[model samples]
Target: MPATAPSASSAALPTLLRLRDETFDPANPGAYNLYLLASPGRLCLAVADVERRKFVALEEYQLTTGGVPALAEQHDFLSLRGWNAVRLAVTGRAFTLLPSPLFRAGDELAALRLHHTPTPTETVRHTTHPGLELVNVFAADAALADWLTATYGATGRMLHHTSALLAGIVNQRGAASPRRLYLNPGPQELTLVVLGQHLEYCNVFACTTAEDVVYYTILVMQELGLDPEQDEVTVWGELMPDSAVFSLLRTYIRNVRFGFRPGNVQYSYRLNDVFEYRYFDLLSLHFA
Candidate 1:
């Protein structure tokens, strides 16, 4: 129940979701590995037993407001709650990828332009995963980057939300249906990833209603030559089973199912009480 900054900002937004283990001891920070995820509408942190690969604690706060302006403030407030050594991942939509061979460290913003037109003041950065054979190029506001570094001591592994989503999907690919569509929906944005032999397609769409969700999803299905009546579509992020988005998706796609936790990792029973699909990006940070 304790928080880092119980300011008017925290009071205004309120904590929308929270889950943690009774075994967690804030005093022994070094006993677990910490992961932090900051998004436009949510801020989250989790602790896991590195060796056992089990999540020990998890927390999420929903911002009444959205976008980069509120991230630093919410993050500073979350920091006061409790955390040890940490890994920070920013989950905004402004990110693109370049093959590792073509990536130039100082020109992340330029590389991002291959796909996006970043704002003038956005802080551009890149992280390479040699195994994935691609460098994730992303942008965040300068102030948010500075605050994260000052508080977490310079993040060595900066992940875009897509990186975690891909990692999670790849880890579960073996058990997944032969063809699948994975959707991670945020406040007013949805990230769609189509997986098969390789990543067939991946893109983010700005959406506001259940109708918009169905339109984009079906559009991608058509572009990929997928049959909505047969192909399975697994969803995660902001929507729930009974939510409008999920219901609408089910109406169009016959095999609509919620995603499961990363198949390759172990998790504590505490995490089982919540829907595994909810924090696929945050928990998958272990694999990223």
Candidate 2:
């Protein structure tokens, strides 16, 4: 759809969460980095002060419908540019990671084909993590990729959500940290990542019940020879400490805890009310 004014529904897009620091200046977009997270169910925008390394703004919209083309039409800031930098993280399970030594730029489709069937309207995108010596190859919505190009052009790049999650794992994991599991729970789905010195396993699970999430967590742990009674599991996103998912997760595993915001960056006092562990993927976009 061509760019146009926000519709009545678009203007009222439920703002699930919104925080703007006292220092944030919408007029001075050129001074900050804008990070956008787009998925079928959620759309998020975060702004970081490049000079201070502080996150000055955050806006999350819970979407019952819509896609990339709706983004600029729904939010004026996205249509405007002059951002110091921008990176949009596309969320989906149609992604895979290969070691740098085995990956080639032109082979994204073939690599992703093993795990996901890319649709005709999707475009292949890759982000190489030199520190981890791995390349994440994933498929992004073709319209979303094209829209980013038309709006930001050379000013931005696209990344897979796993890239940000992995970046968070690496940045937060200590040198002496034991083999640990990370769970990022989302609406009707769960993502599990295991870290053993290096990334050992990562996968997304389609789930509907609390039982499904806990069952898969334990199964993956046992399959990987991780003892549920002794191993550590950290969780972030979509669940409260009192939620059924967390309750059941604790029953199966001994070491269970929530995640925290990235320690490297400062945040507005306004964001303190938000759960620390929430939006790990969005906050970690800075690391990706």
Candidate 3:
């Protein structure tokens, strides 16, 4: 049974941007895998038909504010629009990792509860990545979780944005820099992940300007002992070619370059006109 997409006449919100392949078919929902990414004030989604090896549609919505309430609203909107079985990757900054050996199922919330000073209103949840041998603990608003459970029966697979980003980066096999730094920038946040023989550092920073981007990138490099002139800095996410952030990064980092979509997955020609680096996390969910 194929799922159906909402009609184009569906009510419109304050969308930041929306792109769709001409071949996108609401009648052939079974042909695509849907991926949804929610951040503090933004939501990015992509639908890829792996059987056909192409992306059918993608959207980036700008929320007035991001948090539990915002996520609930966006999630509901998608659900009402007939999108189902959503794989949610949260981009909020409330995640911590634990080794698999140290993780226990009943106490996922307690494992990293101290790390996140969740208010009485928030709830903590945990997801384990056996492949990475790491446990991810994150927080969501209690009300949001309840609403989702009541609305959809349960919160299907939920992943931290960090997990999605790292999975996307590790899944890229071609450009293996022994000691490389990968950045995924968003509205007011920049996620930095360092990779070597193993994962070195992963953290997010709050920034909204070109200078802040450069400052944080260089600061992390210095602390990690990566040379601006020597090591590679690969970036992905929502910046334009002529954008201030891209321009500043190139000026300071010698080996910097934009990242491409994961090599393992096949992209349809519908995505030929779209830049490879954009919607990285959303598209990478095919592997996630």
User: Against the true structure, whose TM-score is highest?
Assistant: 2
Weakest 10 consecutive residues, lDDT, candidate 3? 1-10
lDDT of 1 by residue, 1-288 (tens): 443334455455556655566666555565667877887766777778766677877777664554433544654334432344466778666888777898777888678887778787778888776656878898876666766666556433466878878887887777545867889887688889987766768788899999999999999999999899988888888787789888888888999888887776777677776888888888878777
Tens-digit lDDT track of model 2 for 1-288:
222233354567677777777777767888889998887777888899999999888888876545656756676577777889898998778889899999987999899999988889889989999878999999988888888989997988899888988898888878888888899987677889998778899888888999999999999998999988888889998898899999999998999999998778888787887899998888898898
lDDT of 2 at 194: 94
Candidate 3 wrong stretches, greater than 4 Å: 1-11, 64-77, 80-85, 147-155, 174-177
Whole-structure CA lDDT of model 3: 0.74
Q: Name the lDDT value of residue 124 in candidate 2.
A: 90
Q: How far is candidate 1 from the true structure (C-alpha RMSD, Å)?
A: 3.8
Q: State the TM-score for model 1.
A: 0.84
lDDT of 2: 0.85
**Candidate 3 per-residue lDDT over residues 176-243, each given as its tens digit:** 55878998898788999888867788888889899999999999999999999999999999899899
Model 2 bad stretches (over 4 Å): 1-11, 64-66
The CA lDDT of each predicted structure is 0.74, 0.85, 0.74
Worst 10-residue stretch by lDDT in candidate 2? 1-10
Query: Candidate 1 regions off by >4 Å?
Result: 1-13, 64-85, 154-156, 175-177
